[model samples]
Target chain A: MSDGAVHCVVVTPEKTELDVRCDSLILPMYDGELGVYPGRAPMVGRLGFGLLKIKSAGKEDVWFVDGGFVQVTREAVQVLTDRVMRRDQIDRTAAEADLQKALEIKPTSPEASALRDRSLAAARAKIRLSSR
Target chain B: MANIRQLDKRRKSVRNIRKITRTMELIATARFKKAMDRAAAATDYTKAITKIVQDLAKSGTDVTHPLLMPHESVKAVDMLVLTANRGLCGGYNGSVVRAALQKRAEIKEQADSGCTSVSGKRGISAFRFANVPVEKTYTEFDDQPSFDAVAKIADELISRYITGRIDRVDVAYTRFVSSSKQIPVVETLLPFSGIEVPQDDSAKGSKIRDDYEFLPSAAGILEEVVPASFRARLFKCFLDAAVSEQIARMVAMKSATENAGDLIKSLSRTFNRARQSKITQEIMEIIGGVEALG
Candidate 1:
């Protein structure tokens, strides 16, 4: 938290992955990516599968996050997810294989469909992240 | 002389047992510290989720999550008992099983077809011996249970609960308070009443309820956050049970080692007395033989 930075905390059920001050942070919402600056109103939103792009000081960092939640206040953004992986950790080949596996499963119910979609999204996100 | 030899053998055996128990106690102590640290690390996540739930509750909106409301009447319930897979942990498994059995008995009339699901071998065997039918048994959850491992179980329970197949869910496990205290308690997991407002320094009385915005509606957020909170709570329970199990084992082994020490002490005392008596008898026999020779 400085003149033009917002503190960001990425939390998961298993562990807290990151806590950093950033100039700008983009979060993956249920529908699309949402960017936040230093002075944003407090809001809560559901997260989807994608890269969490963070630009701090002069460096850029990207992380792959599965569906979770984000609580963005004016001073801070708290991203809570069940899974978070660094950009370098994403494996493109594995993700492509997982995407194929996800596509093959037939969803029996709405919940199953949702789960399948999440897996599909996650696999795609990992592939996209790894390519970059 | 024979008595001294027998005492010496018993003392040696007791000393060996003491060595074993002392080693177990040291191992348990190390594990307990690690378990305690893991539990502490999880507390942050648990508390954060609890805070969000509390803020939602206080936001003055009509919260309408299925998990928040209790099912009508309760036709049947699922009982989950968590115990240690390995059994050197004194009464840790016993306390959990006893509590679970008592709960099973109390809910017998209410639940028509409830079957116990146990996570440890110790508990499953206890239920099996009692002739109680266990529907599921999971032995993979050891002293160190990963979140994914427990999440699968929680996800299953959540799905079953949401489907209305199971009216309620109860779990019996030992709760770790500190290094010295652990209480065995059976609590409701479904129709979850465990979510409470946190009494912490951060974010309490912030009065941000009026300014807060819930994206895609409050209900949509609840759909994800509620289930996640439930999963986290269940995971926390597993962690507590793990830490408590180590404490129980540590205490049990320490006492066993001390008891062995006491037995060795008494055996050595008896050994000394027997040796002295044998020496005195030999001297007397020599004196008698000399007198006879005279």
Candidate 2:
């Protein structure tokens, strides 16, 4: 921690993506967004696909995360998910192609609809990241 | 001269074989290092997942996750045997198949029947020679096992176990103990007996437990994390098996090259001896002819 900064760690299945000391963080939650500062209450919440804003050491680092879980405690903040990519890694063209395919799903059943919806959300998240 | 020519041919063939084995040994060594790194990289993720499991266990909850409990009654089971796809790996594949067969035999009467699926052709052939019926065989895998591939297999096994189609799921693979030692062992995956974390986790586990608010609910996350952790463990098993396979290949090829060297040496010695005796016999016969004339 850089003089009272909160520790933030982003972990994925393949690797520990990042561990840094950030003054503040804004994480995506299921319904909306979550922002945490130093000395936050220990809480765990389901995550969503959106940008994670980390302000640390007088610099800003951003990452686009796929849904998983985020936990905050007095010690640090931990975000565990399957996919975490930086802004540069997002492929807008691929996401667009996936959206085109996902839109074609007729979704005749509940499961199909949910699958389509998730894919749509994922594609949209990709597009949003790429545009930024 | 004829004998010398024969020996030279044999020596040349042996030398060629030694060259090939030596190259293979070097390749296997390089591959083993890469596999070892991948296996080591996966260790942190595996350990983290284990820590999460431990925390869940300590969270003072009922811990009634579906994955944590074994299904009632011993019905049919599923066993996946992992072996090298290619041969010349010494006893690497042999040990895996042997351990799996032993386990399968031990549970013969207990379970009504079992499905034995093998990864790699070596195990499949071994089972075939033994007249053991293999339910399925996978040969697409190489030294590096893609997580998605292993995950797909693990997911299917887990789902099958959950649906009561299989009461137990066991994996027979070589566990990488160290550079010089690897042991083939059978591990129960379904009915997921708790994870084995590295030693560091045990030491740090004593830290005061954080009061974590449930995300959606603890049960919901448990539903995901439990199986995810199981998947992680299964993937790690594949990684360890890969590293072990490369090590086995390296050692096997090295010994093969050494044997070729020994064979070449002996063959040349015999050729020299044969040539010397032939020359001596010819010279003695000529001298005997001269003495007879005198």
Candidate 3:
């Protein structure tokens, strides 16, 4: 799989940061993680808030993505997301603070409560990844 | 012949107006630059979202999002009127407002024509005039956009869509195309079918095909993604309009300043000629009297 390189591009609202040929790619989807290679079958998946890892040449790169979508065609791969953060860019202290706030937010009403849990989960993920 | 006193007064008046327009032109230029920077930054965001949306459509998902669902009932429509809080740019506000009014009238006419109803009922009278119930108009901001403002507007639109209060949501704005041309465009905000992705071969070449693993589920992520995308897009639109307005104002002022200069120059020349002629006439009369007395 490493020999058959796959071309991919990752785009955020600010810029098209990565456009390179890669050996393989892994994305965190709503259900689970998915892997793609060159000549892969066409499929689309809902991305979740997690690490998006792409391996190209002999180096691996990781990006913390805030929910977007991924499209795979026969020859190219595209990742479009609102926000993408590199590991170096992620401030551990800020992530921790956000995580703490998310955890402390207790919605008294059922209607407003759903997003709190989601935010908490995201905070935890950020912390866990930052520590690594 | 005009009096010297009157000429002096006219020059002073023109000088004051020149000062005002010159100041305005400078301010408008500065604001226009900032707006352009912001507008450019937002493009990346819009492109990223558009790509995601296209990918979702490509992916065969049973997940039905409310934003995606077309409202079959077309009894009434909601228009979001986005206008500058203050008027200075030539037609920036007026053009957008006019486009909105025209659209409203057209929608009313369609409703009146008695088109076939999707729900098998006389679709509510051809046009129900509903003033854009929600408006987000602002005059000033710090450096960047106020996310809170965008969120407030988004919340209102989302609730309206969810409760079936408005069947469709449309936004009317003046899109900044260039310094000389600001086009008034009306785009659908809700029931998101009008969102377009770049179809050029260059865009196609950039398309990414890969499988993704969702943490919770696709449906859950979409509920958040769609709304966030909408809010981001609206913010971008505001930025675009702001930049366009400032540029328009700057250009308008620059031309006005030039016109003022021309007027002052012409007036001064005329005033000087008239004064000279009056003095010459008095001198000739004095000479004639002296010659007659001699």
Candidate 4:
């Protein structure tokens, strides 16, 4: 409700993961990372599999957001993704195993390649976020 | 009068039936709670994505996606009927089948060809008995419908719509209004106009910020968002159907249990009366024998 603070909400298919007010926020866009401040213009960005950093006051909350879409409005920054997890939620061994499995897939067809690529990206993001 | 032993046997069977119905009622109640929680959790995501799609459609940017564009001429149509796989849920499956048949007839009147796909065994069997031809039948979905499972269906429908294989997609499902209320209805899913802007104060409050800056581009985002939203909507239908089926089963089983209780009570009353009458007859016979001997 304040002018200098940004409100962030992360929504997944299962539930609304988090809703909090923060001083600033960073989203991993399809191309790169984009930061949002209180007075940022409204925008919609495609999310990539990476960490979503939200900072309020001095503490920061990091979330591993799977690929989806993000909509930024004046009042709130909405992250619409299939899954969102904290660092602790990501299992390193499982993600690593998934990456290995994804890497072994032969891209024989276009659909297969797409599947392989998506899995590879997702697993890699999970591994990377969890390592941090 | 009926034999007292036969009456007792009937009463025992009724008591056993009551136990089974009561147990089923409890199971349905628990499942209903879980399913309702799942559906409630999905509401936020569904509402958010729908709102985004609505705002994009009303953004007036000449943004047109294939999913958002209506076909010029109606031709082939796809109807997906969602019913419970197992039937014990009173008229849940029946009403859904009726609604689906009604929708199919309406579509036939308007379209040249219609393809019917049904999920759940009850629906498939109903369609078969009705002599209606079904293009596909699915038995995988139960009380818990995963988003991925629903996404596969939505993707197939989307591809069909895009390739002009079908002009529109209609889903006949029971919409769960609350724990106590559910209504079976057919909803249009393609040419994707089902997302209506609510006339509530929230709609007025969240004015479609038309000045939205597209990160990559409006067209690119619309391409992804439109389909994602469509998938979300379809998935929501599955979730609602699941929850409603549980509720219907719970109510049906509760009534069954109550009716069984009443049946058992009446059976016991008759059994007692029969036994009493048998005893009185035996006593009368003994007294008559004594009088004859005297």
Candidate 5:
């Protein structure tokens, strides 16, 4: 099979996520999952918290990003997220600890509870992505 | 004619003033260099974020974030006005303060015009005037900027936005364009209208087209990303303002130092001439006495 045709850059405050060409891109957005390839129409959408997977050269790269946005055009795809973490960077042990801590917290208000839930979900996502 | 004692006193006072300015110039120079380095270092992060945001904003997403929406109600507005804690740079603080005052007036006018709620009054005004509640004012951050401070400010703004305490948020600061020029700017921080793509002549004729997959949901991701993006952007702005202040101060001090040096040189020359004239007159008087005695 020909080498992966997709090329894109994933950026966050800390560093660049992925700058390599790939066959396909799977991004986590606010609405749902999005798949991208070269020569696609331009679009803008809100991003959500989840794993972004890029497949290229028979290899799959995974990144866990906070909510942001993604823009796709004919030539390149850009993913702008607040936090981008590679699979290796996601410490399963730490994530598990955070998840446990989040569960133990007794929230006093609805907003606090929702925040706790988001924290838990983030930790769970980290653990899940690392394990993969 | 001025007496010797008076001249001596005057000379001493000028000398003291000279010393003070000289010291200030040195301090300003050192601080300026440090600030410039910091400002330069911060650009890396800002540019990176800008590019990413631009790209993401350009991409099509279905989720409509709250920050993106403009609130019609003008019940309250939060203005993040950045000014140098210490004033020496020419128009830096004045320009920023002026902009803030203008904005405050505009808000008040809107309220009076029945464009907004009658009870809608300026809630908080931070900095110089201290008329409004100062959420926070930062002086020196280790000669550069502290990330912790930025994070705290960002958190406050985000919480305020999320809670609807303020209908809108804007940042007024001096955008450091060059050493001699800083433009006071007021930019909207909330409602991620869209990422602003820097103008690049090369990209003028070209277009980007690609398709992507959204994981979980686009709306969910936007909910998280928009706030984070906003916070980062604010932090970057603080860094830029700090750097600009230092640079402006440095240039201003450098010139002051040069001017002071020139004044000192001219004064010294005049003092020497005065001393010489006095000595010559005394010698001539003594010679005249000797001739008259002969």
Candidate 6:
């Protein structure tokens, strides 16, 4: 880590996508967005499907992450997710189509409703992030 | 002579086979490199998840989940045998099937009812030949297995274990130790008790517990982390099987190509010697005819 930067790493099942020293990190938690800086308390948080913004040296890098988990230690912030992609990688038309499909899913049972809600949230998050 | 002609034919065929085996060896080499890279990349996730699980276990919270608890008694056993879809990889598939069969026999002796699930056509056919009924057969996976595909199977296994449909889940596969060494073994994946927390040397001298703040709660996070760790373990098995398959193929093809080369060399040598002796005989006959005419 530099003077006030924290080491950040994002790992997917297939590979580690990013490893860098960043000034700050804004991650989407299961409940809301949480920002992290150097010397933050060690914590483990469940991630939601949304944007992950890493700011360093007056520049910002953003990525769209599928639901996973994050661990913040004294030295580094680790993000373990299933899928991570750049905002431009999200096809707006496809995301809109997914949202429509998720809406059409009938919540027949508890499991089915849970699935519907998860997909609905994921599609909405994609659409919201890609449009920015 | 006729013998020379036969030798030439055999040499030509051997040469052609050598070409094919050489090509296969090269392909296996390339594929092995790619598979090894993917396996290495997965190590990070596996290490991270294992650390998290260890921490959760040590966080002073009573960790209890369906996966962490053993069944009342051994009843139904699910043995998942991983093999290759295609054969000709020497004893790669054979050893795996053999190991799996031995495990099944042992499990059957203890469990009341059990079923064997096989991945790869080789294992499926072997089980059929052995008159053992297979509960499930997966032939879609090749050298490259996607995480999503493995996760689907893991999800089914997890649900079965949770609902008490099966008492235990075991996987038999070739563990890739390195490029030169692979061992076929059976491992239990469920019950989630295989993870042994490493003893911290620094904390051994004094009682120091790193204070970790949980987002929701330690138990809640453990609930998610445990299943994720299970999925990761299953995926690692798939990856190891894939990489070992390629390495086995590479070595098998290399030896096959070498054998073909040796066969071709000996055949050509015999062909040359036979042709020379035939020429000498014809010359002698011609010289004798000349002597009689004179």
Top-TM-score structure, candidate number: 1
Clashes of each: 0, 0, 22, 0, 54, 0
Our tally of clashes for model 6 stands at: 0
Better of 4 and 5 by lDDT: 4
lDDT of 3 by residue, A1-132 (tens): 234888877765445767888899888875568888777775555677788889877788888876666767565777766668886676678778877876775565442365566566666777777787
Model 3: which docking level applies?
incorrect
Model 4: lDDT to the true structure: 0.84
Q: What tens digits encode model 2's per-residue C-alpha lDDT throughout B1-294?
A: 777888889889999999999999999999999888777766666665555655555565455656667877888888999998999999999889999989989888788657889999899999999999998899988888876677668767765665567888889999988899899999988788765423334566556667777767776666667666777788888888899999999999999999999998999899889889989999999999999999
lDDT of 6 by residue, B121-205 (tens): 9999999999999889999888888887897788678766776778999999999998889999999988777555665535666
Q: Enumerate residue pairs that collide in model 1.
A: none
Maximum-lDDT candidate: 6
TM-score per candidate, chains pooled: 0.88, 0.80, 0.64, 0.80, 0.64, 0.86
- Classified by CAPRI criteria, candidate 5 counts as incorrect
> For each candidate, what is chain B's TM-score?
0.93, 0.91, 0.80, 0.91, 0.76, 0.95
After superposition, the stretches of candidate 2 with alpha carbons farther than 4 Å from their true spots are: A1-6, A20-23, A45-68, A71-76, A85-132, B195-209, B285-294
Stretches of candidate 5 off by over 4 Å are A1-116, A119-132, B1-59, B111-135, B140-143, B197-210
Q: CA shift at B73, candidate 5, in angstroms? A: 1.1
- In model 5 chain A, which range of ten residues has the least summed lDDT? A1-10
Q: Mind sharing the TM-score for model 6?
A: 0.86
As a whole number from 0 to 100, the lDDT of residue A91 in candidate 5 is 74
lDDT of 2 at B288: 100
lDDT of 3: 0.66
Off by over 4 Å in 1: A87-132, B197-210
What are the runs in model 6 whose C-alpha is more than 4 Å off?
Answer: A56-60, A86-132, B112-115, B199-210
As a whole number from 0 to 100, the lDDT of residue A129 in candidate 1 is 72
What TM-score describes the B chain of model 5? Answer: 0.76
